[model samples]
Target: MSEDLPIRKIIHVDMDAFYASVEQMDNPDLKGKPIAVGGGGKRGVVNAASYEARKFGVKSAMAGNLAAKLCPGLIFVRPNFERYTEISKKIRAIFYEYTDLVEPLSLDEAYLDVTNNKKGNPSASLIAKDIRERIFNEIGLTASAGISINKFIAKVASDYNKPNGQKTVNPEEVTNFLEQLDIRKFYGVGKVTAEKMYQKGIFTGLDLKQKSLEYLDENFGKSGRYYYHIVRGVQNSEVKPNRIRKSLAAERTFSENLSSEIFMLEKLERIADEVSKRLAKSKVAGKTVTLKIKYSDFSLQTRSKTLPYYMSDKSIILETAKDLLYQETLNNSVRLLGISMSNLNTEANKKIEEKSVSVQLKFEF
Candidate 1:
């Protein structure tokens, strides 16, 4: 097992219902009730939901009004970003006490490369348990950890036992673990991609492993190479600390396919508004406006426009996206639509402003 694997010690830690749990912790009156944290207004979507809410089928990204209908007694609490940020800092501090290679995926989850940790702990499993214990003892929040040789499997292992538990995928167990795992459950595979794999009769990691790299590449594009390697329990991407988001986006998969020009134009306006708000919170802007389209036939296409200056305001983002959408020729009735900004500029670079211009390029996913 040691001969076949590099034997790296990676750990992925994820907090359970972070925002919702924090709300419950800070307010005793909220305990034992189904609660969701986010904007709960008519147009808002849930950001996090307490475990109690899960019974009622409430989920993050679910429309708030829909969630209310599902869980009639559900409590809505506006997010306290300052508090969540404070807690996240404490959690990161605890991880840094073990290893400096901490890659934060979001405020509630991170990947830690503890191959050579400060504690001189040889057992990654023990280290993970120690970290979770520290987080719970110090912050009063439960965290789940996954331990393994690489980031991909470690992430998968972390989910095996969630909300205050941990799972370790040892070197000896990597092969069988991958074989039995469902394709849909793999870390990076999304619903659309999973459906594509299913259509090709690839239902599990074992099934995915049967395809040649050439076949995968032809069928799935660049991500095919990614699938080929991770299924065999081989992934070498380092746990990079201080990673910056390359793009900020907002997209929606409609309940029904949209082919009407009027319907799509309205959807794009709404999506652009959402994207602009996210960019504002991040205090960033970008020069590239990317429009992503997924058809009902499951085909995907991306069109992008790069402006001379960064624009994060809704009006500019909406206009640029509209331009890109109009230029493209839809191959089928659209099932999904997205707008994203890239070539990001942080708040520090906010001083430079230039008139927006559209330059279109096509990309395949």
Candidate 2:
């Protein structure tokens, strides 16, 4: 680890099987049973699975029918986003009690910088413990947390002890911790990237650290620099309290695959309406309009057009999406259609540069 790198108390908190847990919490009959949160109808996907369901190899995003096949008698419950959002708001309220420097990644996870928390607590580990305990008590939900010197390590550690647990990588342990970490477990390394690293004979952080910057860049392009620093426990990105929206999107999977452009036009209109509503609600518009198509074979294709002016009108968005839709020939029957707007007006809302800690702080939990 470099001596000049920032050392701040960062914590990543993630709720356990949030949607499934919420369903179980609300319905006593669903407790202690294998359940998945999402529609069980054809074309339905699992949004979240209970631990009992997971034991049978059922997981989120799996086809609902496949999940049922994996776990015989697996119960599927429709998603209740409104209820989930209600619970999420309560959980976020608890975070604000400890620190204003809270960054929510989603309704189920967040990152908090508690180095200068309201409680004046110096032990980030204890702070995480307190937050988890409060969530369990107040919201009837279990949360796992990771505490460390920076966001990347903290995020990784949070997964170490999941479903009601916490892991802390103290300042002194950061180097050894990261060096022993599996390359696949590094924050930004996905399945494809992990395979790429494996081909390069890089299976662990120690292996990644051995590669020169130019060597990594030559092979991995822009993410090469990210791989270089994170392996050395040198991530300096801060948790932004006001994380601005970069894009607004909406999509839907049909009950039956559409075989022609005319059938998709109505569906695209509805999707555009949703995207336009989201853009209006966010008070932002964009120059880029993208249309995403998912064939019945599960292949995805996206066509985008950047206009001279920003658009948030449903009619205009529908017109652009229709153009993009006809721009390419159908590869197969379409299972899903989506519309997204990017190059947002929110870009101007970005705050000025925020500095990370430069001096080492003597601390222990």
Report backbone clashes per prediction.
0, 0
What is every candidate's alpha-carbon RMSD to the true fold?
A: 9.8, 2.1
Q: After superposition, how far is residue 22 of candidate 2 from its true place, in Å?
A: 0.6
Query: lDDT per residue, candidate 1, 281-339, as tens digits?
Result: 98888999999998988798999999999889899999988888889577889988999
Model 1, backbone clash pairs (residues 3+ apart or across chains), number: 0
Q: After superposition, how far is residue 325 of candidate 1 from its true place, in Å?
A: 9.4
TM-score of each prediction: 0.75, 0.95
| Number of the predicted model whose lDDT against the real structure is largest | 2
Candidate 1's TM-score: 0.75
Q: Per-residue lDDT for 1-365 in model 2, tens only?
A: 36765557899999999999999999989999999999788899999999999999999999998998899999999899999999999999999999999999999999999988999987888999999999999889999999988888889999999889999988778778888999888877999999989998999999999999999999999999878877877666888998888888999999999999999888888899999998998899999999999999999999999999888999999999999999978999999999999989888556656344432346765
Residue pairs in steric clash, candidate 1?
A: none
Q: Where does model 2 exceed 4 Å of error?
A: 1-6, 349-361
